[model samples]
Target: MTQVHLLDSIFTRLVAWSIAVCTAVVLILGTLVGAKFEQLSVDMQEAAVNADMATLLDAYRDGGQASLASRIDERLNFRTPSGNAPHYLLVAADGRRVAGDLTDWPGIDTGEMTAIPLPDGSYVHARAVDLPAGQRLLVARESAMDEMVLNEIGIAFVIGGLFVVLAVGVAGRITAGRLSKRVGRINAAFKNPDERRLERLDRDRNAQDEIGELTRHSSEALQRLNRLVDAHRDTLDQIAHEMRTPLMHLDARLLRAIRTAPDDAAAQGLVDARGDIRTVIATLESLLDISHSEANRGDPRGLEPVDLSAMIENIADLYAGSAEETGHRFEVDIAPGVTVRGEEMQLTRLVTNLLDNAFKYTQSGGTVCVELVAEGPVLTVADTGPGVPVEDRDRIFERFIRAKGNHGASGGSGLGLALARAIARRHGLVLRLKPTLRGACFEVRPESTVDAG
Candidate 1:
C-alpha cells in the first residue's frame, strides 16, 4: 500500500481552513474592541483636562496672573485622584511660558485636544483654553495605562490563536487516521466482493454522512456485479462442458476412418480432417483454461510455491533435442534461486507455449534463446524468426488471432499466445512482447513482490 502523508489528507485541509477563519475573526474583533476602548479612554481624558482648564481660568479671572501661576504650580506638584500627575503650562500674550513644567506654548487652538511632542521623544495628550489676558492654559497627561492595556490584549490574542491552531492540527491527524482505515477497508472489500466482507461495512450504513451513503451504495453495486459475473462464468463453463463430449467422439471416429482408408490420397484427406478436428479441440480446451483461470483469479487455492528457475531449465532441456533435429540452435540461460508462488502446471504451460511457437516459426538454422533473470523474477524468450508485424502485434495475444503469413506454414490453432497470456495473468505476471530487429522477443515479469506470494 502506498503511504499517505498527513498534510495531504482531507482532514488536514478542513482543520487548516477552520484555523484560518478563526484567526481572521479574532483579529477583526480584537481590532474593534481595542478601538472602542481607546476611544472611551480618550473621551475620559478629555473631560478631566477640560475641568482642570476651567478651574485655572477661574483663578486667573479672580486674582490675576500671579494667583493663576501659584495655582498651576500647586496642581502640577500634586497627583490627581486617579494617581496620574497632570502637567500645566500658562503662556503669556508674548507666547512665553509664564509657569509650570512646559517650556513653551503648544501649536494648537484653544479648547482643542492634541498630542504634544516632548523633547524626550515621548508625547502627552493636552487640551488648551484661552484666558482673560490672551494667555493660554494647557493641561496635559501621559497615556501609559491605555497603551499597557492594548499591548496585553494583543499578546493574549496571539497566544489564544496559536493554541486553537495546535489543537485543530492534532484533532485533524486523529480524524485522518480513522478515515484512512475506513477507506482501506472499502478498497479491500471491493477487490474481492465476498458476502461476509461486504457485510462488515453495514455497521456504518446508518450514519448520516457522505461516507455512509458511499459505503451503502458500493456494497449494493458489488453484490449485483458479483452475481452477474457468477452467472456468466457458470454459463460459459456449462457450454464448454457440453461441447467437449461431442468433439471427443468426432475425433475418435475420424481417427478410425483414417486408419481404414483404401488409398494414400483418401487416407491423407482423412488425416487432414482429423488434424483440423484436433486443432478445434485444442482451441476449445485453451478457451476453457483461460475462463477458469480468470474466474479464480484471486482464489488462494489456485496458488502454490514453485521453483521458477528449475521449472524453466527442465522445460528448456526437454525441447533441446527437438530443436537439434529441426536444425535450430536452442540456448537456455537460467538464473538460480528464483522462485514464485503460482500454479506449477500453468507456469510450465506458459513456458512451453512460447518455446513451441518460437521453434515452429523459425526456419532451419535459426536460433531460439530462453533467459531467466533473478531481478524482477523476469523471463525472456527470443527467436531468430520473422518478427510479428507492427499491425498484428497488439492483436496477437487475442484468442483465435494469428498474423497474416503465419496461418498455413505454422498450422497453429491461434490460441498459443493467448493461452500463454492468460496463464501469465493467473500468476500475476505481465507478459509483454518487446520490439526486436530480427525476431519476436517476449518478456514475463511479476508486477510486484506481493504477487510473488
Candidate 2:
C-alpha cells in the first residue's frame, strides 16, 4: 500500500506488469465462465421442454386427466436448474389452471420454441402437444433457483490473481534493493581507495544480466583510469625536475661568459644573445614543472637522509654577501645536526625557492630571517619580511604564481616551490605552510626523522 507508481523504478515496472497480467486473466476467465453459464442454462431449458412433451403425450395415451397432470408435475420435479425447488405450473389453452404445483402467476412468456419466462417468474419454452386439443405444454425454470456455479469460480480466479501479483512484487522489491546496495558499495570503493571493504562486485561477469556485466567492466576501467592519471603526473614532474638543474647551469655559464668578455660591441651582442637563450630555456622548463606539480598525481622521488640544518646555513652564507651589500639584515638560525630523509637536491631547491621569494618581496633595507628547526621528524622554515597575505599565501606556492608587480622583476621560472613540493612528496614527506603572522613558513616532514642535534 505504499502507492508505488509504474514509472518510479524497475520494481514499479514489475508491479505494473503483474497488475496487467491479473487484469488480463480476469477478463479471459470472466468471458469463459459467462459463456459456460449461458450454455448450461440453454441445455437445461431444452431438457425440460422435452420432458413436458413426453408427459403430455403419455397423458393422452393413458386417457386419465388427473393422473396425467400428476405425472407431468412429478416428472418436472418442480425444481429449477439452480437446485432451489419451486412449484411447477401449467396453463392450458382454455386459460384455466390445471392440476399442478403453483397457484400464483408471475407473468412468463412461453414462445419461439426457446427458453422463456412463465407467469410464475420462472423460465420455460415449447413442448410437443396434440393439435386437436389446441393445447401446448411448456416447462418453466426459476432464475434465482438455478445453479450458482459461476459465483465460486469468479471468486477463486480473483483470489488467485491477487496472490500471484503480490508474490511478484515482493520478489521485484528484494532484487532492486540488493542491486542498490551493491552499487553503493562499489561507488564508495572507487571514491576512496584506502577503504577496502567493498566486495569484488566487479570481479565476476558470468551473470546473464546487463548489470552484472557492467560491474565487472567498471572495476577494470576505474583501475586503468587511476593508473593513467598517475603516469601523466609522473611524466610532468620528471620533465620539470630534470630540466631545472641543467637550465641553472646554462644560465650561470652564460652570465659568467658575458662578464668576462671584452668591451667590444660584437662581444657584448653575443653575450646578450646567450643570456636570451638561457632565459628561454629556463622559462620553458619552469612552465612544464608548474603544470606537473599542480596535477598532484605523480610518482614521488627517492628519499635519502639530508642535513637540512647545514643545508639552510650554507644557502644563507652564500647569499649573505649580497644581503650585507644591500644593507638588508639576513638572519640565519639553523640548529646544528637536524637531519631529514628526502632527496637532497630537491629539498635544497625547496628552501632556496622560499629564500629567493623572500628576498624578492622584501625591500632592500628590510630584514629577512631564515630559521631551520627540526621537531621530531618535522623541518620548518619561518621567514620574516613582508609576509605573504593570508589570501595569497597558498597561491604563491603554486607554479608560475607571482605576486602583483613582482613579474619580470626577477629571473625565476616560477616553478621552484612547485618542484620543491613535488620532490618533498617523492621523498614521502608532507610539505605545508605553518601558520605565521610573519613572511612565510613551509614545513616538510620525513617519514622517519629526528630532531636536530
Candidate 3:
C-alpha cells in the first residue's frame, strides 16, 4: 500500500498549517469555556453565601429533588453562564440530598465552589451553603468539559486535513507535469537533426545542476564525435585517391607482361596480379562508401516509397548461379509490393551484402536463401547459412570486423555489414540481427524515424 508521508518537504508545510489552524481553534474554544465556567462558579458561590437555609430546606422537603433542580436551573438560566448546565442539585441538613437527577455529589470539595464533576468526567459548578437551621446546602451544576471542545477541534482537524492533502497532491502533480514536459521537449529536439537550437542548448549547460552538467558533457562529446567523423572521412578519401595511382600502374605492368610473356606460367602470374588489384579496388571503393555515408548522415533528404522485395529479388537472382557453381543452392523468398522508405541504391547494397555473406559461409551443397517479409512498415531480411555465433553477432556490424572462424578467408574487406548498417541508419531505420536458429535474420525496424508516418 502506498502511504502518505506528511513530514516530507511539501507535505510538511501543509501539515504545519493544519496543526496551527487546529491548535488555534482548540485554544480559543478552551479559553471561552474556562472563562464562562469561572464566572458561573463565582455566581453560584455568592448565591450560596446569601442563601436562606431554612427556605431552601423547606423547598427541598416539600418540592423534593425536582424543586431543588428547578431552582438551580433557574439560577443558571438567568445568569446565562457559558460553562453551567441547566440541571443541578441542592443538599439539605440532616444529610438529605436534593438534585434534578443526581443521586450524589459529583466531585471532591475544595471547601469552595470549583467545578461540578459530571458522571462522564466533565465539570460544571459545585457550591456549599450554610442554612439557618444549622444545616448545609451544596449547589452543584452538571456540564461536559472536553467533549464540546474536542467536538469543535475534531471538525477543525478534518477540514485542515483535507486542505493539507489537497495542497500536497496538487504540488506533486504540478512538479511531475513540468518534469515530463521538459523530458518530452528534449526527446523531440534530439530526434530532429535539423534543429540547431537544440544543439546550441545542449552546448550551453554549465551550471551546477545535474541535468545542466550532463547536457554540457554530452555537447562536448558530440563535438568530439563530429570531429572524429570528419577526420575519418578525409582519411578514407585520401587513401582511396592515393591507392588508385599505384593500382593503375600495377594494372599497366600486368597488361604488358600478359602481352609479351615468356611462358604460360608468367602470363598466368600477371592475370593473378590483375585479380588481386581488382580486389583491392573493390575494398577501397567500399571504404569510400562507408566514409561518405557517415558524412552525409545529417542530411534530411525526403523519403519515397520503394519496392524492397523487387530489390531483394534482383540481387538474389544476380548471385543465384554463382552460388550454384560453388555447390551451394541460392533462393529468394520475397513478398510482392513490400514498399519501404529509403534510397533504392542503398537498399540494393544492403541486400547484396547479406546474400554474399550467406554464400561465402555455408559449406558446399549447403543452401543460401534471401527473404523479405513485410509487416506493416517493417522490412526483414533473413538468410540461411552457418549463422553468426552469439558473441560475434553484434560485432560483425562494426567496421572491419569479421567473425572469427567464419568467412575470414572469403575474399571480403569485412565492410559489407557495416555499410549496410550505415545506410539503414541514414534513412532513419534500425538494422539488427534478429535471433534465430539455423540462420541469420536481420530486421529493418519500422521506419518511424522519418517525418512520414
lDDT of 2 by residue, 49-144 (tens): 566556565775676556667776676564444543333455566756675555543344444344445555555443333323544444444444
lDDT, model 2, position 270:
63
Q: Cα deviation in Å at residue 30, candidate 2?
A: 3.7
Compare candidates 1 and 3 on lDDT and give the better one. Answer: 1
Report lDDT (Cα) of residue 144, candidate 1. 65
The full ranking of all candidates by TM-score, starting with the best, is 1, 3, 2
Write the residue-wise lDDT of candidate 1 on 126-192 in tens digits. 9888777677778987776767777788788778877876777678767767777777667767766
lDDT of 2: 0.62
Model 3 C-alpha lDDT per residue in residues 142-252, reported as the tens digit of each score: 443334554565566566656665675566556545444444434444444334735654543644665566666655655566567668878877887899878988899
Error of 1 at 174 (Å): 2.3
lDDT of each: 0.82, 0.62, 0.65
Worst 10 residues of 2 by lDDT: 293-302
